[model samples]
Target: MFGSLGLPELLILLAIVVLIFGVNKLPKLGKGLGEGIRNFKSSVRTEEKTASDENGQDATKDANNT
Candidate 1:
């Protein structure tokens, strides 16, 4: 639904964010956001790997039982 945002909309959103957070805190905000996103991505990857490994083990167990 939000896919239609263009340059003006982005600029206005940025302006609002700047007004809310102030320029001095922007760097810290960006750093925290980056770190949070990185942590989230890493956790998602770990979960996916664990799930795949479990599925593989289950399949092997089923084959041995047959």
Candidate 2:
């Protein structure tokens, strides 16, 4: 997935993150990342539901016409 990052570049990025957050905080950071992903998924599902509801209403109107 990280096709653009060579070994040195990846190491540099990791070093920066480690410096900023430290080793002890990585787990907490991971948990927060997971929560963020879950929230995003839920938001996407809600948007899909709203769009489907609108489409269903339109379909019902079309059926009524026929």
lDDT of each: 0.98, 0.97
State the displacement of the C-alpha of residue 60, model 1, in Å, after optimal TM-score superposition. 0.4
**Residue 35, candidate 2: alpha-carbon lDDT:** 100
Per-residue error (Å), model 2, residue 32: 0.4
Over 4 Å off in model 2, which ranges?
Answer: 1-3
What would the per-residue lDDT of candidate 1 be over residues 20-60, giving only the tens digit for each residue? Answer: 99999999999999999999999999999999999999999
lDDT of 2 by residue, 39-66 (tens): 9999999999999999999999999999
Give the Å shift of residue 48 in candidate 1.
0.2
TM-score, candidate 2, is: 0.77
In terms of TM-score, the best-performing candidate is 1
Candidate 2, poorest ten consecutive residues by summed lDDT = 1-10
Reference-based TM-score of each model: 0.95, 0.77
Which residue runs does candidate 1 get wrong by more than 4 Å? none
